[model samples]
Target chain A: MIRVDENPEDPQTVNELIEILSIQLNEPVMKSTARLMIIISLALNKKLTFTDLLEITSLGKGSLSNHLDKLKEGGLINIKTVFSGMGPRVLIEITREGMLAYENYSKILKKLLSH
Target chain B: MKETPMDLSDHLKKVGKEVVRLDFYLLKRAFGVYYATWAAAIFTLTILSYISGITEQSDTYLTLYGLLDIGVIIVAVDYTRIVFRKAHMLSRLESDLQMSKSFKTIGNNVNIGILIVLIVMFAIIGTNIFPGDLNSLLTFIILWIVDLYVYMVTRISFGKVQPEVILAVGTFGFSNTASCLEFLLTGNSVYSFPLWLVTVIGWSISSLYSFYKAGEIHSTEIGESGSRFS
Candidate 1:
């Protein structure tokens, strides 16, 4: 929702910004803010319970499952069922590929903001 | 398939806030349990040591103080283990390096503390470096120094000086150090500023505060229940 009306005076800087945006947009999971928020939480915490993720993203169960499926299909995360006294619980953890992707996104964002 | 309406910079800023929030939540839970444990240990053990001293049971008093030192070190190492397991479970969080170093630092500190305590115990029991009259005072000073060192290392590990820690350090540090100084100068123990009272009051307050903080943290919802980030 934030609008950046003032482009950088330097042509090269504008080009760099456009390139960063394009790169982010091309990534299927990275392009969505919801998935990025989930990734950020996972990347920082390593593993989180399904309830933890639910509280974090505030997404509905079905919608959250869809996002998780996309993230799983992209090989960015792994989901495993854990049985406890309460019952079966889903635990999600970020993969190495997911971590790298998060790092790349972070670096690109930092680079863009610096301009 | 759905594009974010926000720009890249906005996305980063928003996600960054969530990251910090999650990090704080996990640490708060871990340290809440830690503070509560220490509160119980200090309150009970200090009272026992005080009783042993008043009963003229010199051996029991010394043993209790030694146990307190060892017990505290065990707690410190246990906390490190908890954090280590959390880090290992997460696999590759950005804070892993700092946590690994904290484990080593806490390990080295515990070893050094134990070595010092053992040497002091040997000198007290076997050698004449410390007179019989000074046995209790010496133990107090040693325990004070050990507590202070542990507090410093804990502060470094946690990256912030929590209120529970400050309360403990202030209470034990002042009471023990002042008692030793008063005994050294006046040749008599300060009955009015007894360690048992100080510990009971200090740890009671600390435990209450820590439990309250923990309760507050658990009550706060991390995010709105139905609002989607997208």
Candidate 2:
């Protein structure tokens, strides 16, 4: 029942860390690592266009499309469309689950790397 | 199975740098447009002074302006292309980043302030410039139209912008307006220390409006490499 914030070296912290490690290591969610990075990056922004992702990731259209579709299907991200005078623009934003997954992934990654 | 050739840490650093580069590139582009537009304005005024016979006796001024025009035109074309093709992009990026100090209204505010300066200029100098009262009024109207043209061109090249673009553009607007106001204030008809004080007050009004909002001044960040020229 120890809060992770309240105590650093409590046995509960180790148990919770181990549980987090196992969930991250074994879960099908965010297994690709690239997808994890996508979520993490999106977490840092309010929203990103397909073009933004393309520039930041340097991934080709087809490859980026495949990843985006998978993320959308997994409910980790949402692809919304808006119409401008020029044309329709697609905006990608991370969902709550995506944000939580990223936060968890980052915490675990930081802890593991620090060790 | 998807490829996992690289580590997340490496990807983070690599992506991080690319975004940083893009941010700096955009900041530089915005600043470039602001400056180029200023140069264009100078060229315009030189043409005006020459046409109006104000600088008729000043060959040196003409030659200097002509040389400066050459450089300004060259620089302006590149900056114009970058800015016109990419209006509002900088604001969008800052919005995406959820930057708290984003000065979204500064561009519009600055524009309004400059228009005020033009209005004051018309009030003070309209009679001398146009000679006849009716001609003066007509000239004032033309001035409004021309100012709008210049302002819109500058706006399209760099408006609804945020972060350093807003700061740079807004500062340019104030300085341009202030200097122009100073010319009017220091005109022989009303030239005096009191008017100079009014000019300083005029500058403070525009500058304080632009920089003091957004809760805290991020002009400090304007110098950050994120604030660095491209």
Q: Rate the local accuracy (lDDT) of all candidates.
A: 0.60, 0.47
Top-lDDT candidate index: 1
Per-candidate clashes, comma-separated = 0, 0
**lDDT of candidate 2 over B36-139, digit per residue (tens):** 46444444544544453443557777687667656765565555455432433334333223323334335434544665676576566635654554453444
lDDT of 1 by residue, B13-117 (tens): 555555545545555555556555655666555566556656767776678677876787578557645654443323233232223445445545564565467
lDDT of 2 at B110: 53
Per-model DockQ: 0.18, 0.03
Q: Candidate 1 lDDT, tens digit per residue, A1-115?
A: 2233343653333234434433433344334566776776777667778887776677778988888887888778899999999999999999997776667555544444544
- Give the range where candidate 1 chain B is weakest over 10 consecutive residues by summed lDDT: B89-98
Q: What residue runs in model 2 are displaced by over 4 Å at the alpha carbon?
A: A1-33, A109-115, B1-230
Best by DockQ: 1
Q: Score candidate 1 by lDDT.
A: 0.60
| Ten-residue region with minimum lDDT total, candidate 2 chain B | B221-230
| Model 2: chain A TM-score against the true structure | 0.69
What are the interface RMSDs of all the models? 6.8, 11.1
